[model samples]
Target: MSARRILQLGNPLLRAVSTPSSDSGECERILTDLRDTLHEFQRTRGFGRGISAVQIGEPKRLLYLEFRGRPYTLVNPEWDWRSEETFRLWDDCFSFPDLLVYVERSCAVRVRYQDLCGASHVLEAENDLSELLQHEMDHLDGILTIDRAIDRNSFCTREEWLRQGHPATRPEAFASKT
Candidate 1:
């Protein structure tokens, strides 16, 4: 597997819901590509924690994440629960790296998913992890960070956002988990 091109904003395929993954081999291939692509983006752009297969034009229900030195591959994930209390933050995406959007997200979440080997596992995430899960999950359903923007004014260019000292929405930094 190799680094693949990330689907940018305005791609029609980014608007299409991804299909559930069934083939383990294909899932692994996509997972590897996702890992490579995410790392490359991180190396060059300096930030990115997770990526969905759909972002690489696969349109499969798969997500790859590297956080705190741990790597996770989630296949056909499902939401177990989400916290009622939420927080707002400026979110960004590989699909539209130049734009930042203010959005609200659950403070915590529990998810169930299978690994590349078909083993089932559950992940209980809070704060940063919660937002990362929510962000990648949105891609499987054809949703983008911009789509979650709180309002018409909830937008800013990367340079402007940086120049403005990266406006904070809460105690956390104004960065999308990915």
Candidate 2:
């Protein structure tokens, strides 16, 4: 499978709402392309953790996220559960190119999705991987993190993100109890 080119911000595809997978055959191919695209981003950007089909100009409900060494595919993925606890962290997207923004998301989430074989699976995720999955899954639903950013002023370049204290804290809005 060939790696697909990523669609940057302002691309219409990134704004298009992706449709869910209809059958097993279509899902298999999308899964392969998703895997290839995930690898391509990691290789070129040196730090892509997840990507959605919409980001590649495909309006199919497919996404891939790399955890450790394995790439996990989530087809028609949705959050089945989310914790009241929330976390704020730095997030960047391939579509947005080089901009990084501090954003808030659920600290722990359980998602349900289908695999290439059409088998449904529920996954429990936490920490950065949890955030990565939710971020990409949002793309499938036509949601971008920028839409939920706590501070529009918090937007910055990757270098700026480094210049800040670089502390990982709960989202300012969530008011988590430590």
Candidate 3:
């Protein structure tokens, strides 16, 4: 397994709906490549927590997550629950690392998925983890953060965001339109 090229923002394959993955032989290899590619991204770009198979040109329902020193391999992940309460944040993607999109997301979520070995498990995430999972899950369904932007003004370049001091987002910030 090696670090594969990440599909860029304009790649048509990024719009493909991923197919469910099996516990067959390719699971381990794909997961490995995902981890390698994630590490490579973090090393080069300095910020990346998770990646989906589709991001690496694999149209499979798989996700690799590493956050807070723990790693998770999610196969065929499905939403078990999503909180009604929402919050807003500026989200970025490895595929489009230079752009940030302001979007809203649920405050919490529970997901059902299988491990690399095919063991079924459920994960409940809150706050930051919730948003991160939602982002990656969107990738599985051929969605990107830009698609969730709050409005035409919700986009900012990484450079401009930094120039403006990388504004902090409260866990309760709604950025409501009403």
Candidate 4:
């Protein structure tokens, strides 16, 4: 239940695709670590909603998230459907906490995944949760938010992003075809 060290952006482990976890015991341990690490990040860094096992150097297809007070554990999650519509937003990650990448994501998504007990479930998410899940799922596939940046100017340091008064407020700056 200890908070594990989250691998940083340049770590090769972060670039490797995570393998699916078949053991319930192993999945439980990873889930606990992800939850603990997510909470630790929020406590010290002020914000974090989700984390992937790869972010902790486990290279397992597991992610844990806490959104709007509810906790979620996604094992071997895969996209079942995505909306044709998309939206632009400033995306951040636990692997690169100091950077903000402006990216586009599906406005809605449906994902099928397994629980810790090996029970399958479907999660349909929209808006913020949709983006958050997409972001974490990308980690399972060795993709980072920076790789999904809308353009070269899509990157900003945390300080610069805050100075700009939040990218959501300046929609014109992120204007690009979705």
33-89: candidate 3 lDDT, tens digit per residue: 999999999999899999999999999999999989999889999999999999889
What is the alpha-carbon lDDT for the whole of candidate 2? 0.79
TM-score of 4: 0.95
- What residue runs in model 1 are displaced by over 4 Å at the alpha carbon? 170-178
Order of the predicted models by TM-score, top scorer first: 4, 3, 1, 2
Model 3, position 95, has a per-residue lDDT of 92
RMSD in angstroms, all models?
Answer: 4.2, 3.8, 2.6, 2.0
- Candidate 2 vs. true structure, TM-score: 0.88
For candidate 3, give the lDDT of residue 8.
Answer: 98
The lDDT of model 1 is 0.91
Pairs of residues at least 3 apart in sequence or in different chains that clash in candidate 3: none
lDDT of 4 by residue, 1-178 (tens): 8999999989998889889989999999989999999999999999999999999889999999999999999999999999999988888898888899888999999999999889999999999999999999999999999999888778889999988786573366345433
Candidate 4's displacement at residue 86, Å, is: 0.1
Question: Would you estimate the TM-scores of all the predictions?
Answer: 0.93, 0.88, 0.94, 0.95
lDDT of each: 0.91, 0.79, 0.91, 0.91
1-178: candidate 2 lDDT, tens digit per residue = 7788888877766767899886878777767787887778777777777888887777898888888887788888877998899977778888885677668889899999888777899999998888888798889877887776766555667675657554465345533322
